[model samples]
Target: MTQTGWTAGRSARALASLALCASVVTACGSASAAGRPVVLSYYNEPDSSPATQDAANACSAASHGAYRIVYNKLPSAADLQRQQLVRRLAAHDSSIDIMGLDVTWEAEFSEAGWILPWTGSEAQQVEADTLPGPLQTAMWNGKLVAVPQSSNTELLWYRSDLVPNPPATWGQMIADAVQLAKEGKPHYIEIQGAQYEGLTVWFNSLVASAGGSILNANSTAPSMGAPALKAMQIMSQLAHSPAADPSLSVQQEDQNRLAMEGGTAAFEINYPFVYPSMKSDNPALFKNFKWTTYPQVSTSLPLHSTLGGIDLTVSSYSKHAALARQAVLCLRDPANQLEAAVKGGLPPTLTSLYQNPAPEFVAMYPFYKDILQQLTTAAVRPKTPEYQAVSIYISHTLSPPGSISPASNLSSLTGQIRDALDQKGLIP
Candidate 1:
């Protein structure tokens, strides 16, 4: 193992200190345990991998022997479903006191009352200091229902050697790609086009950067027609460029990485989780690579990237809701969060931790200072039950072989979303 500032022994000592400090101080109010072991069902993404087991151990220890964790790591879309969430809740009423949910599921989970609102003062303090994008995600309508465990946002990853100064416009992106290709290097740009969650995020950033909104004002009418067509034109141009396949486009980040590290491509738009592996996969190739905030459409604005991460919430029916809440507090503690970040590749949600990371954190990733700045500018997707359907429809239709024209598909998707908003009485 490459040496890092943190190790199991150091983490244990730090956590032990936190446990002692927390044990003497009584909770503001004694939350009812309701007579059961607190279970935390987590729908973990791959970015938070490896440390999943360790995180469970830390939460268990920090809870002061108040809860037992039931951890779940579902790696794909099939694993994230309403039925699965419902089934788990039905199986054991007292169990699953806490859950780690996706950003998009915040509204659905809150509306269903699957998770109780996060109301403690300690939680509020955390939320108060949170960056806008992530804070918005933790809320449903006006209610603060969840707290971000560790959030991630996309950024531009490019070869510093090939292009010391990255492109700042769509025109520049194409010109640079052509220049790089002419120089006997690979293509210049890479993005997710797959018919999955990644596609929704990439598309959202593209449209937003073009100064377009998906849902209409009041979120009650179709608003995506023209902007989407414009966005599609940009993507279609990039697709036909020498770097990408005109006949087929890889729709995921993994493929993007292959193109990037193999020197098959000069640029990649991806997340920080890919950093460690990139270094391991080809140390020489990425030794001078750069991961920075994406260039904006205009010189003055920051490129808007979507916030993608999970939140920890409590089950309303959990027999051990109080203990579950405490478990969340334990996980959010600076020491534990920092440790998790170093070991798990989780970006710290706590601003203090993000600003002044532990030594281990700094050693694990030197570019965290840059990463934190980009994350602060991240934007949250609309949090409504309709968002899921909107995202799925947009992703499916934009990818080739779907019958709808880009403009037509976008118009129809927004219409369906508006109908959902009206159904919820969010708009008249």
Candidate 2:
């Protein structure tokens, strides 16, 4: 595998700074030196329920007085969570024992040595338990850098009562949507077209569904070619079509969901949370809703849903690395994952959970099989330390999708992606 010079230089600088911080704190020698119990601080984005806290409490009790787990909540936004963690880790804050990481962050965090690597029996167990796509997200440069705790993927949500059979391809969906619009029902399709992470996700899935990727196999350069152009062409056409939501350029996932629930759109692509949320907010609409695998870009190609969710990692700067690892393992236990799914609406990474879902998850059993299948086939965005830059380039360049022309913009898009990967024009 080839390493980028930019990443290497940054990693060296980060390590040097960490060394200085370590000297001041005696390298955070131990979690505890005296008889007092060691405290392990876990930092993660806040969850809606106390499932994570409950698991931490259970693990602490199970540790037999060895350590106590302290929860530190980060901002809800993924970017903010990453920013906060990066600042602390760069400073060598040993208090960050464990961290809840976004799946896309595994590559960056592992490459920069901000998180610990998993090996041996533990690695084998995690690999064996997690579904393939989610498991792959925790790996970086051929090593397991984290453990998949919960996993998510997009699904094609449709008004089943109106259209009994969902379309199999994007072309078909668009055609049906156009027909619906002509019938005086506008906004037939709801999608995340805003210039944000959601747009990147949508593009990733579209490219993958067309049997292409944003980067080559090694992930060191841009690989957006014909397939990518085709994906963009489809997106452009949809945005300019009569069936599109007028606010397409500004629509986020929540707005799309609300549009669908408000009886404005006939179809949407969103995460599983919408299922339960709709069930609670509008039972009548929820009853009419149904979901299936994300629509394929072509009839011959299989659909590729975009992956999302969290991973658990032991912070490389943690003083209590060993105990933190144990705590992470406990927190990711299948039982705890099941509880998180039941109470927090987070999907379990464990394959067994899909085979035999817990009672709490049974309420959505109608969609579980399809959800699990989509998770297994999900496509991940570029796994690079420069992913933030890449995402920004793609989202910004393709904003107000109607303005994009595959024929004229493909080369420019590829150039921009390469620039981002090379750290050119980066904000630092």
Candidate 3:
């Protein structure tokens, strides 16, 4: 059996034994009264900062002996993290009290009844206080299923020293890149074009910026048509352009960042993490780094950068559901959010935190306003239970973007997306 399968089986047996022991008021029940606090397990991706751990410690202390949180580190890769959570939740593992979920996983988890829904005052507070785009990520089927902690949006990073006036549109940017290349300058435009989640994000942003969406309002069918074709054509042209990265087909976000830091790329579309990563890796390169809202597809259209980030979700099977909810609120409190932003370099989800950022945040103030603007106007990916399969089909079909021709591939892309959503030929 798979590791997750083995874990689920073991958890089931343990829970069954605990249930029997509780019935007789024996060891299991006595352990609770014998100075054993109600332990809550929080599963999340690995983080280098102690900010999250510190916050958990603070919350545990504030619980007044009610509960303590035990951190469970998941794999850094998002797909792996989802796989681990899905297997355990599918088996109704009650030990999973709280979880850190990717924004795109919210719909899938909620639809599968893997997460607990937030309602009443908590829902009202989350809706009122968080940025609209990030808050939307926590909702599935018009109900809140998670609470956003930090939010991320892509920015167009450019070397201000090389290109003083960055291009405002994709056409302009490509033209400038081509000109720079002609001059024998080591400058190219870096983007995530690999057949992965990053490619889905880039495609969604491009389509949205062109005044279209990947799916219809209800996510029941493909809404991509002319706008999508236009976006794909743009992507194809850039991939084959003189200024295109040679390894664009396999490049992800980190590769894009590395290219920019190596001084080979004049512009890149990447998340906020790139800022701090650049600062620490090569201070000299960081000096020339600047960011702005993603370039528009056309002058008449507004940029709709894709939203990315994590959300704190409560497990449906958690034994201490109330305690888990309380811990979530504590973890997302304004003070904790600010601490995370300053110490961990994570952008805060609270809208007000951006308005009056802490001193550390202000030090990197050049990108602050643009970051907030992008977050406010961010475009979300398709919100559907079948989003994972849809993303896979979209990304795989568009791989090696250089060879894609919108006229020939649009229909196939749309059909495959629909088939994936319906589970027509895809493995269940």
Candidate 4:
């Protein structure tokens, strides 16, 4: 089985056991919140396994017997966490006292009133500490609804030995790949272009590189135009190109392993988690690999990468909001952040914590500091309640090559999105 698949199986068994234990503990009529600690459950990605554990431990120490942590390790399904939240909301809307939300879900969860709003001192602190992309992502109609715990910035992972210098433009990237193909080396580039979230990431990156915004700044209309169409055309060309080694089936992790371990692709676009496995996966291969910022397309305007990250939030129905808030504060503390970074190589969210990362983290992921700067320039998807459906529109429209002509179809899609906004009274 794939590592992703294996992780999912293990998590299913673990959650089942935890559920039984939790039911037993609840059935025994545990002490009231006034006497016992306020407990909150959070769902997290498998890549964040160590971060969740370290964060929970830190929260426990900071809470000093005032709170406890419950983690739900999510499966590998594309929307597993989102679907789980909806299922939990249906059964008990307030059951999840504390939650973790992906930047993309800010709109849907906030609109559904599934997230609790931040207010007073905590609101100011969270806003002051968070990275702009994630901070903005956690907001809904100008209200701070969640705390950005950390951010995931996309970067280019390449075989330094294979391609000494990264390509500077889309044309250059293609040329580099073509050169590698001619040399009888493996494929040159591995991009996440599947029909899932990965596709959205690639799409956002391309649009940003082309100086096009995915959604209108006003958040009421699809902003796709000429630049966006150009980006789509670039992707279609890659998909249809005979010399291209990558297919539509590749995801981020798959691409990472293929480049880093299999020694096939010369470069892969992925997040920081892949760094941890490089040495163990193939020490010789890892020795020659390097991670760096996304190549500059238009240096005058920052090249945008899609923001992928998680935040800590409280359930709207939780009776433990006060306690959950306290725990969140603890999780955001610099000391805890440092500890988590040391334990898991999870990037620290607080700017101050960037001064000194773990030696191992620094050694394994030498591009850490550079990536921090890149994270600031990353872009979040449309931050409106209709974001999920909007994302669906984006994926469906862009997934297939030659499925629809971008120039014509995108105009029609824009009209359809504008109508959607008008129907909801967001725009005319």
In candidate 3, what are the lDDT values of residues 1-428, reduced to their tens digit? Answer: 34688599769967876786768665675554744468899998787888888888899999987899877889999989999999999999998998999999999999899997899998888888899889989988888999999888888888988788999999999998998888888678999989898988988999999999999998889999999999899999899898689999999999998998888999998887788888998899788888877999999998898988889999999999998999999988888887887777778889888887777778744588888888889899999888888888888888888988888789998998888778688733
User: What C-alpha lDDT values do all the predictions have?
Assistant: 0.68, 0.86, 0.87, 0.71
On lDDT, the stronger of 1 and 2 is 2
lDDT of 1 by residue, 1-428 (tens): 32244367557756775675577555412422332335455445444455666666777866665575656655456335455666876565655566777788888778777886766695676586676777778887677888788778877778888888877766677778888888887665777877777877877776766677676544445466665676666766676677563323445878777767777677788888678878899898778677777655555545677777777788777776776677776766676667668887777777787676677888776778766776677656766666666676667666752233556666656666666666642322
lDDT of 4 by residue, 1-428 (tens): 34688589769956775676677786434433343456676566554446667777778766777888766676656478778877887676666777777788877787777786899988998888666766777888888998877677778878888788877666667777778878887655667665566777777778877788777887877787876787777777666653344454544556656555777777777777667677777888878878778765555656777787677788888887888888877776776666656565556677655556667657655787777777677767766777666666666666664354668767866766666656542321
User: Which candidate comes out best when scored by lDDT?
Assistant: 3
Cα lDDT of model 2 by residue, 1-428, tens digit: 22377479658856875676577676444422442468898988797799988888888888888888877889999999999999988998877999999989988898888987899988888898789889889989899999999888888899877778899999989998988877776446889999899999999999998899999988889998888999999999898888789899999989998888888889998888888878888899888888888899988888788899999999898988988888888989988888888888788899999887876678755678887888898898799988988888889888888889887778887988898888887532
Lowest-sum lDDT 10-residue window in model 3: 28-37
The lDDT-based order of candidates, best leading, equals: 3, 2, 4, 1
Off by over 4 Å in 3: 1-36
Model 3 residue 157 CA deviation (Å) reads 1.0
Stretches of candidate 4 off by over 4 Å are: 1-34, 46-50, 90-92, 249-252, 339-345, 358-360, 401-404, 419-428
lDDT of 4 at 154: 72
Kindly report which residue stretches of model 2 are placed more than 4 angstroms away from their true locations once superposed. 1-35
Is candidate 1 or 2 superior in TM-score? Answer: 2
